[model samples]
Target: MTEVCFVGDADCDLQYELLSRETAREALSTYDLRRPFENAIALSTVSLGAAVSLCNDLNWYVVRFVDDVLVREPSVDDDEWLSRELATAVRDGDVTGPDTGEYLKVYGLEEPEPTPEDPNPKGPPALVEPLYVSRQDGAVPEYDLRDVDDTVVVRLTEGEFTV
Candidate 1:
């Protein structure tokens, strides 16, 4: 099976923005209706197709938020659930949570950078500023995983696929 991630690049040269969860959901819905999912490349293709559909709908004339990618100047909505999920994962110690160094070591990914050689690195930064969380009043939380102190890596593998 192919691996899928919520990887993104917010400040690329192209200058696109991230969408809130609700907007993304709407995009997903439109994508679902526009394209029929196939088994050949389920996750990756579907995400790309949906993103393209959304772009076509909005007339953005660019690429952004396809699959687990965030190309261009992505600005997520304050009330998006994925943001919360990421926060919870970090706080609850999920696999894709914090531990930037460890994430890089395992997946060969890199956190976002001003001039990144690899946009889709194995590891990514856990917390970013100006995230636009809905409940901005409360002290915004970061990396509240099960063991905030521990570091871990979780991968999905199948026959003939070893990393």
Candidate 2:
């Protein structure tokens, strides 16, 4: 099954509870992240920005953001170390770490399957459509998420992630 996670607006204390869901939330949490090998693509608002800043800081590839997707094509050769460093930077909230040199890899993919509307699109459309919260519960929509490719999507719980 595709793995996923979700991130919501949370305060400092709330962040802890949120992280707890990282492993427990359904195999597919609310967050939908793409594999960083098709070309190190970032596909969310925060991650996209992180990718761009990482590229600029490390002189890696030019990170491109088309809608919610972010793409970085390594500008230099042998960017394996660079990519790993960038990933660390992103995880640690540092673009240029003392341990990680100024470089990034071009491992993430640039193009995913194309939807009819976004032809030759720079990136795939948003993973989660606007949430349709319903006070009345019976009409909630559902998605099977059985056949998605190269993606990890987390499921949601009673205001939490189950893993």
Candidate 3:
């Protein structure tokens, strides 16, 4: 299965925005949605091509409400995710195998703080700003932007590497 995860902009309510719009809602009607992170929505597709197609189908809404589009194809790497552009490239045969691991965007997985009302906070982790890095010797550096319980490493194509 290829999973596509949509991370929303800080000010947007991603779920409501996508589900409320007729076109976006229609495009997403077939899949079961999952929230793997705060302000994010995820769905699974049979293959990388289908995942890219789904993203393309929702591009209008994605551009307006989404901050990031991440795709995970188990055939590539089960532990790391791929940027939408990279995923598209892979599906289109522009990238393959170990070449996919060269550039990366590492995001910190920050857990919500405990509050008086909810001491033991239990919600999806918030993804922090991504730190773009290139892989060296088959490994990328640890995320050091902030304190986080974990990190999500997203592979990127050369075109999508901001830094």
Candidate 4:
């Protein structure tokens, strides 16, 4: 079972509620997301088409939408993004905190399987852009998060992140 949690979109109070089917549905219906509920991709297998649908539907960038597993090779841009993150982690070292290998060891498979030379290369397309919410006019979507109960929503609180 593939799991996905909203990574960005912090300003949208209902984002935390998006992890649950019932709550996600309620939030989707209540908000003016402009995208159809039929297209939402939270907690799903995350097919390439589904990734595209979620990214395009939510006006998200191709990297913000993350999945629990590596469903396919990341887009060139996403590969660069992950590389930068890895560089920063290596620079940070134990002095910075926990080890960062947890990410790269698992996700980096840039050298596609079957080597593209194999007559039987079977899998997702060679290049895949991750699903992500785009930057909205260079500004974060601002919304009041006071109404939602903390227990029901699972997300980092406003203070836990730097805008």
Off by over 4 Å in 4: 1-4, 9-42, 60-163
Tens digit of per-residue lDDT, candidate 1, span 1-163: 1112343334431212323444544544422121111101112223323433344453332234332222111121221212212323332445332221121111122234443676654422432222111122333333333323222232121211222
* Candidate achieving higher TM-score, 1 or 2: 1
- lDDT tens digits, residue span 1-163, model 2: 2111122222222223323454323322444545343222333324434444433442311222111222322322122222333443444565333333222111122245667996665644323322322223322333233333322221122222111
- Give the poorly placed runs of model 3, Cα more than 4 Å off: none
TM-score leader: 3
Residue 112 lDDT in candidate 3 = 88
Clashes of 4: 8
lDDT of 3 at 34: 94
Model 1 off-target regions past 4 Å? 1-5, 9-16, 20-152
Weakest 10 consecutive residues of candidate 2 by summed lDDT: 1-10
Please write out the lDDT profile of model 4 over residues 8-114, one tens digit for every residue. Answer: 33333233434344633553353343211112233332333443334334432323432221222132122212222332233334212222212222111222346
Best by lDDT: 3
**3 or 4, which is superior by TM-score?**
3
lDDT, candidate 3, 95-118, per-residue tens: 795689988999999898999999
